[model samples]
Target: MRTPPPTTRPAPPRAPRRDLYAAGAAVLLVTAAVLVGRHIQGSRHTLSVNWPPLLASWDPHLGPGTPAAVLVAITVVAYGPALAVRLPWRTLLPVAWATATAWTFSLALVDGWQRGIAGRLTTRHEYLQVIDRFHDIPGTLRDFTHHILLGSPDHWPAHVAGHPPAAPLTFVLLDRIGLGGGGWAGVWCITVGATACVAVLVTVRALADETLARRAAPFLVLAPAAVWMGTSADGYFAAVAAWAVALLALAVTGRSPWAAGGSGLLLGLTCYLSYGLTLVAVIAAAVLLLGRDGIRRRPVLLVPLLAGLAVVPTAFTLAGFDWWEAYRLLVTRYYQGVGGVRPYGYWVWANLACTVLITGLATVAGLRRSVSGLLVRDRLGTPEARLALLVCAALLALLVADVSGMSKAETERIWLPFAVWLLSACAFLPRPRAWLTAQAVLALLLNHLLLTGW
Candidate 1:
């Protein structure tokens, strides 16, 4: 018996999976080729009803190839983090944030201060003056709410008319602080860009493991979605929604009442920022129910979150206007405007194509692996599986948006929040560097070759 006890068999060695890496690289190259072809053809045939004229007119101040070359350089710099993945979390975090900020500024500030900042200000002011008559904050809110129910005598800013008070309230705050111009827009872009990166890391670490979070960091930093994060208010909206999910993640993992409340407040704020962001409730719910232990404590999380969400809207309701009614009226007004310009038939597929472009083709491969992982009973309860579920939730929300006809075009910016989650699918990529490169190429093509109003 003693002799038999000494006989322990040696473990078998694992096989190398180099083929997976090759497959990932191949997918990346093919995707990059497709995006390049699209960019060339798109210069001739723009899909956007609003920006067709702009796209058709080539106006690159940095010569024709300069934009592409600059983008390539930025893409190469953004890869620094992926190369340094083994570094400490503290070191990696700053690098990720810095690269993301630089990348955003590079794309956004391509035309220099005048065209980037002053020009944007001029456009905003003209639109504000023409559409809303250039009223003060209180006056603007009053008129905005009034026009929500009553059809305007004049054409109003579609964004102002459709969003809650919080949307324009942001500009009002900016004005009060003496920071109301295209320069401020650029500032907002950098601030939101950095915040989004942090929120995403926090959310990933909370929901999954630190290793996974670190792996996701580079992709988040160099997201193709930066094409819009530089100039769109939706960038700020993406940050807000991302933090909401992150706090919800914390609330579930730590079982903190305050975190739950904070999550709810942010979620409520997102609703005010954009009507469509209410769909993020799906992500919140998914986070709350992610782990087995967390399931029983869902009410503890939901109650505070709902209470926090109700606070601001409740005040708005008591002040004078009912948000529900305003949103209802907006439905009709929204369609009468862009809905007619951008048809559902074209935008439905086009938006999906934009998503593919924005998230990279490796995402498609990762998504397939995630789906397969989710389908297996043994893997169903793993963190990767739960995260995959979150990605699916975002995609499902996007599908609903495409089908609704409310979002005709401009989805590259509009889909920023969803794209954040889509990037999560990159976790399943065999070689993250390959996927990041693909994303960088796509962002370069989108920002440099194409002209978008956002």
Candidate 2:
């Protein structure tokens, strides 16, 4: 008789000493940011931020959305887990999106309509400030790099000049379609940003397995990161970047040529949306590595993906918008503006504090489990490890951005694209409702207590 080959199965998860300790570390980081940030802002006054780590101010109050935000939080915490498990896959995706949209909208409304929904993107620093300037579209594209430097004539606004033409062009197209003003812009951002929950769920299901995706759905929907995603253009950018990754997951797993093309299209656009999003390629690389079966015939997928990827840059380049030139000038402009004043020594660590506050305490503990899962040799092919790799890829990208020094303060909002993925760590947690409650409470407190500037 021949002996059958032995197999290794995933062990059941348990509470470890590291879980509590990891969470404690995150809390300590936030406390240190607050204490240290206050001292620097009070003395050197060079942080260029009102709320040390974050860009917001402290204003405790409530509004019409307070009850709704509380109710949504309660409902999600009380029922989201069970419902996530029970719902059909198709139904769950839309439900998650709707719930996330509601949560974001209600939280934004806590600051009321004008301050929250209708005015976020209308400020002097926002993309909307340059809509009229983009009326001469082709001309503007050719002239884009000319205005990137701070000393340039009629220098572009902070938001407009900091990003590629695609960022402001989005609002310009919206205005041309008759949805002008901050209300429409804010609505567009929230509605689209909320879809990121669905994208993450789909990617999780396709890349790892359905079980992990379902476990992650509630956390994705109830994320405190939605506080910034509600109105900021970065929220819109996060959704685009997320769908790019999701489509890439589908393409690599199923080896569908069409899916690869779509993924490529979005991934290219994601780069133009925000330079930092180029780091998403890190996560995409992880997906490719994990999808072993799909990569056997790499050319089948890569060809279409590369083709779709070329469309955006080709169009911009032909139109005379020099992406490379603009970025070089942007680097120089960065050092010339507030980027010059913000102390790298202070922001580098404090930014992680912003991450903890935005992602919530549940993620701290969840990430601890993620790292532990990675250390196991036998579990590399298991669903938990697959998820951990994805989460870690995102963490690596965020850390790279932090270390690059381009992202100092305002990371609470600026890091939304990466922060959304970090919430997926909650899938690794046990006693989900307990952790969900913590996530909910953290979000409610942050929104009601502090006024965010995103």
Candidate 3:
């Protein structure tokens, strides 16, 4: 009996070189995304702020883009914690926090300077600008604070239009709390808080996991779109938060009842601020279909979940004086005509086709019997590789449609998600060298051309 000792299995060997390669490749891709993103931000300055005049003509008392910005900031702050769970904290978090603070201060300074820039305190415009702190009060304080506090929401226009009165809710509270002493002070407070939230979200996300957070951290950090948009206004941040949460829920729980229900609820909430979340909902449905067995086992909760998802439009419809008009406005307004403008003409199409082809190839390679058997051998280990592959592919297709459907050549922001997923798809390949190299070359070249306007 004493001689009958049991055997123990050895731990799996660490693939350090492979891990290094993956990490290095991810960093390289993130660097490329950051560079392209910065170029897009610079392009915004050159576009001439025509919206200012349009907005003024429509609602002279409404102020400029501050309403939109404030709404988005609140949304960003609310969702910041979710992101913090997956992003690196010690280094990247501090930078995000500091930048947000500086940005808020800058907004206040800019607002105050605009009065002096106009060189008179007596004019109606100057007087209003002074009172409002040159629109910076709303932009820096209300919106910025909201972004830090709330993260982002979908369909931001509702809160901005006073339909929900959320923005004013904050304004009223600040007034009562003696936080609204001066427009600039409110702006600074909101901006700093919003910025801190952004950092916290990134840090929290990184701290949650070693492998994923490490890889995703840089892109989230360098994603100029996320930072610039959150800083610029609150809606963009809300959209990002919605997308991030939806993905997180899916990744953590797979086809569990909580996953579908939670994801659907978040999608519905997101619909309030940004309609783009509808696409995410569509993808989630596709995932459910592919995993129908697992999804159906939780049928008792299914009907309610579906009903909740319907609330997005239902709530919006009720908001309008006439539900039909509100529904129509939500559905038809943003269709600036499809067919994304690409100056490269056929070249862009060729690039997209090639990108899709490569993605398809990698996806197909992962479908080998070996891969399938490995997944089946350990059901709890991977939980259906085919489904993951399908999701990855569906995500890629959606990105193609998303980018290609845009009406502007400078719609690179819409295209970022596609680019990110394309790289992610490549990582799934067992032999990632060829796939990664191809994607890197294409991404680098196209991004450079897009940035340089070549």
The Cα local distance difference test for each model comes to 0.65, 0.89, 0.34
What is the Å distance of residue 201 in model 2 from its true position?
0.6
How many residue pairs clash (N, CA or C atoms closer than 3 angstroms) in each of the candidate models, in the order given?
Answer: 0, 0, 46
Query: Which ranges in model 1 have alpha carbons more than 4 Å from their true place?
Result: 1-84, 121-142, 148-151, 295-299
334 Cα displacement, candidate 2 (Å): 0.9
Superposed model 3: Cα runs more than 4 Å off: 1-215, 227-262, 286-294, 321-394, 403-407, 415-454
Q: Report the C-alpha lDDT of model 1 over 230-276, residue by residue, as the tens digit.
A: 66677888889999889888888888879989988988888888889
Q: Report lDDT (Cα) of residue 433, candidate 1.
A: 66
The best candidate by TM-score is: 2
lDDT of 2: 0.89
lDDT of 2 by residue, 1-454 (tens): 2222212233354464566688889989999999999999999999988877888899998988899999999999899998988888888899999999999999999999999999999999999888899879999999999998879999998888889899999999999999999999999999999999899998888888787888888999999898898789999999999998998899988888898899899989998888888999998888888886797866579889899999999999999998889888888999999999999999999999999998998898888888878998978888888989999999999999999999988898888999988989888777789888988888898888888884
Using lDDT as the yardstick, the better of models 2 and 3 is 2
What TM-score against the true fold does each predicted structure earn? 0.82, 0.96, 0.41
Clashes of 2: 0
lDDT of 1: 0.65
What is the model-wide C-alpha lDDT for candidate 3? 0.34
